[model samples]
Target: MDGKNALCRKCQDRLWDTRIPASSCERCKSYVEAGGVCRFCKNGGMEHIVSTYAPFMYTGAARTLVMQLKFRDMDDGLAYLTDAMADALPVRDFDLIVPVPLHARRERPRGCNQAQLLAQGVGVRICVPVGNALMRFRATSPQSTLASLRARRSNVENAFALCGDADISGKKILLVDDVRTSGSTARACAKVLLQGGAREVHLLCACVVWHYKGNEKNGSVAGKNGAAAGQHGR
Candidate 1:
């Protein structure tokens, strides 16, 4: 195995066109390869989350989709993203899937949470059951509004509570979200669920936000002609 690439000769040969995709390498360089944990989760330490996974880093096409979903009333965006996620994430053994609840204010218009849509998609694809295991007890500014990770943590702290009658004790839980930034929201929600008796909390998302400097060039993950995005498995 090439410690530099972390790929054995044969497997390296099997790697697609580029052989070593920058995102995969970067993921390893960050923390994904070290068991798919993020920097904030590793260094600062998440209170209860076990592992986190995403098909694409939040950049290029992934960023575009996220923007469309958040700002525009593009319901179809969820379907496309959900399709991509099915292939990116393995069919893991999770007892229940739970979506990170959106504040009622944000969820009212759509009548549902986007994270719920993502969670439902994951559930169907992975053949797991999904539950509304948590609710947003208090509304806070979006994590994106906060400038520092610490501030982001503070912003989301105490934002979530276990849903009434939801039993998570000893259950392997998959917490689904549309995107994971500093992971503050996921961590907070996981902490609550863990306290509520969840055995293990694993995070799954369609995309993940990591600091990247190359967007003008539209990174390789951006498909042909710099306008398309092909999720990892697709």
Candidate 2:
């Protein structure tokens, strides 16, 4: 395979080519159907997040990369993914980069937390400190296994707590994750960070589900909101 870094040139092209459209929700970056509603905004919780940024839509080669990193432990693509994520960041003043914590049970079996790996890559590229500030104290069903948004939220509600020795008072934090589906997990973590006295919480993910159907066609041209093959929203 002709490649630079871990991804082949073809795969890299396909990965960076999938960009979300400007028609996405201004708050959450979920695609807004023509004259249709954005489920992300409709469900609320945008207030808890300052903005969300992602390098690719969770589809095609992008999905494959995330899956390989998380499930297969093929982290070679971490450099490319985090480089894109760092470029996609809307602001540069973050005091810390914190990965969403995986419960001990899950992390032990998985052997690694994909989110933390991404966080470390992003922190290195952006020159920000990375911290394991949040702990997933409760083990909940995987959000992907849940059907409804309510159920997803319920599953993760109160699942995260701030690490006892972490001092986040008045500091802006960037939360890192592999993929953002319903966003229930991210919001849960952000809520804990905010309550724990973080001044602001922003999100940076490798990819975001462009639409609920997960079948949105890829666009050749980057959208107005697309921040270098990535999308960001306030």
Candidate 3:
């Protein structure tokens, strides 16, 4: 298999075959495949937190494509991501489609937003890609570090702001990002959208850290190291 297919296969295998339970919530179950809200959140009865849908887990073939797309600036790598995002997320009839924005300093050098590229791919299926709906307030340290969840949340707090008069009042908004880590960035961005008068914020990504909680499938196996396995931004 080629690079992209190989990456996807790895993801497929983990989600399907070697699925593991989330460490926290024992009631919630997740596999590497796709679909459904996080079982952990559901079992915990957390209302604020919603299920994050991802087509692939953050490992294997998915990791390779993400890395190349961000580092090598490989258009083909991006092509794979876009197609998957579109297949995974169909944002049709939504009041608006918003992509998480990058800081201007970072964006200038990259010349493109990975989230926007994903949005464009999804838009081909739904016909709506809002590129300038939101903006990052400032640059912050990567979430991989920050020691604790609280620190991660603080790292992204007030990190995003609405740009222009894109009225989303009582309108459904789709928030797109390349990946979902601790969900801190997504939460922070959702706060901005809620404050901007959006009726609701739905989260979508190409991949997310597999936090399966405690389902039988999740506990059955171990997850491979996804660190240094993928890249984000630019």
Candidate 4:
């Protein structure tokens, strides 16, 4: 769009408009019924995270963009994704930006980590440094293949370890990922960073799965600006 070869103007507009609505949970930004408790918060494991930010809901054109980048290895959409993510940052003084790690086996086949790509783009935009602070030492089932939230959580539990020589003591960190579904993966990674002496860990994702009440189908599955503009707090 806009003379870019990544997406058409119509697709770009559709992706940009897929922002999470005010009806979502105040803390985690997942869609919730009016006045209902946020299940992501009630489920716990997010106390280590300070806040979460994302630009679009995981549906429609947004999903397509994420799939293209993640599965198909098409990174043409990185510019658009990082632009939204940078705008979604609430604070600009983060000490470091860290991407959720993928086991070597998984990453070797892909030849690149989408999360790392997003992190590098965001780091450049925000004038922050990006590092490989954590390593996924254990290979686990993909969170998406799991049917339940507990299964997803269990899949990533203790799967991440802080890398040696990566001193994060008292440093604020921005954790980047492509998408957040059950939030299990982000919470798991955040716990590791916190235990490794990170002063604060904030989540930034390209898209987050949105749940709606009833049969309200907002859009098809597919896959931000400003801290106050997109931050979701607990």
Question: Which 10-residue window in model 3 sums to the lowest lDDT?
Answer: 215-224
lDDT of 3 by residue, 1-234 (tens): 122463455455543432233332221223323445445354332223344445665666666566556556666566656655555553356677788888887778778878887776666666764656688978988665454445666787888888886677787777788776556677788778788888887776776655432422222122233343223311
Better-scoring candidate (lDDT), 1 or 4: 4
TM-score of each: 0.73, 0.84, 0.73, 0.84
Extract clashing residue pairs from model 1.
none
Better of 1 and 3 by lDDT: 1
Q: What is the C-alpha lDDT of each candidate?
A: 0.63, 0.74, 0.59, 0.74
Off by over 4 Å in 2: 1-5, 33-39, 212-234
Worst 10 residues of 4 by lDDT: 225-234
Residue-by-residue lDDT tens digits, candidate 4, 23-125: 7766566666784446556656355777778888877687768767876755568888888888877678899999988899989888889899999988888
In model 3, how large is the Cα lDDT of residue 31?
39
Which digits, one per residue and each the tens of the lDDT, describe model 2 over residues 1-234? 112466777787898677656666655666776634455465564558878888777777887677778767565687778888888776778999999999999899778998999899888878999999999999887665555556767788999999999889999999998877667788888999999999999988888865543323221212322332232111
lDDT tens per residue, model 1, 30-79: 22433343343435444577766666555555566665666566545666
For candidate 3, give the lDDT of residue 186: 76
Deviation from native of the Cα of residue 30 in model 2, angstroms: 1.3
Q: How many clashes does the backbone of model 1 have?
A: 0
Residue 99, model 2: lDDT of: 97
Tell me the deviation in Å of residue 73 in model 2. 3.6
